[model samples]
Target: MNIAKNMEAIFVAAIVIASATSFATAAVRAPEVITVKAEATEMPTVTITAKRLTAEEKAAL
Candidate 1:
């Protein structure tokens, strides 16, 4: 009975140690960095023109 209890304690201790170690390792390591480059391009220009309405057109509306 004593040996069984000691073995159980050891098993629990091992699991605790493994969990702590994994957490520490994960916290201590830095994450990977990635960089992306986009190509530059010129856009086309647009022109707009407006015309004034005559008195008859305004009356139709």
Candidate 2:
């Protein structure tokens, strides 16, 4: 039982080491950045008039 346990532990350790080594040896590439020019836009304006009403006119049904 003890021997089997030691072998299992060794197998797990070897797999972990192999995975880490392969990841370390992989090629790394840098990302690219792009520059763009934006066009300016004009905003539109709005004008409004306020009408006044009496309380008696507002409460009438």
Candidate 3:
């Protein structure tokens, strides 16, 4: 019974140590950053349209 308890304690300790090491390494590591570049092109043309309102249309408003 004592031997069984000792083995169980060692197993639990091993698991705790493994978990702590994994967490420590993760905390010490830095995140990677990636950058992207894009080239600009000439601006596209824009068109505007206008129409004269009829006297009757203006009167309706």
Return whichever of 1 and 3 wins on TM-score: 1
The C-alpha stretches of model 3 lying farther than 4 A from their native spots are: 1-4, 30-61
In order of appearance, the predictions have TM-scores of 0.40, 0.38, 0.39
Ranking according to TM-score, highest score first: 1, 3, 2
Return the lDDT, model 2, position 12.
92
lDDT head-to-head 1 vs 2, winner: 1
In candidate 3, which residue pairs get closer than 3 Å at backbone N, Cα or C atoms, i.e. clash?
none
Residues 1-61, model 1: lDDT tens digits = 6877699899999999999999889868587899987675966789778898999999999
Q: Write the per-residue lDDT of candidate 3 for residues 1-61, one digit (tens) a residue.
A: 6877699898999999999999889868587899987665867788879898899999999
Candidate 2's residue-wise lDDT over 1-61, tens digit each? 6877699899999999999988887866657989997675866678778776689878883
Per-prediction RMSD in angstroms?
13.0, 10.1, 12.4
lDDT of each: 0.87, 0.82, 0.87
Q: Provide the global lDDT of candidate 1 against the true structure.
A: 0.87
Worst ten-residue run, lDDT, model 3?
A: 36-45
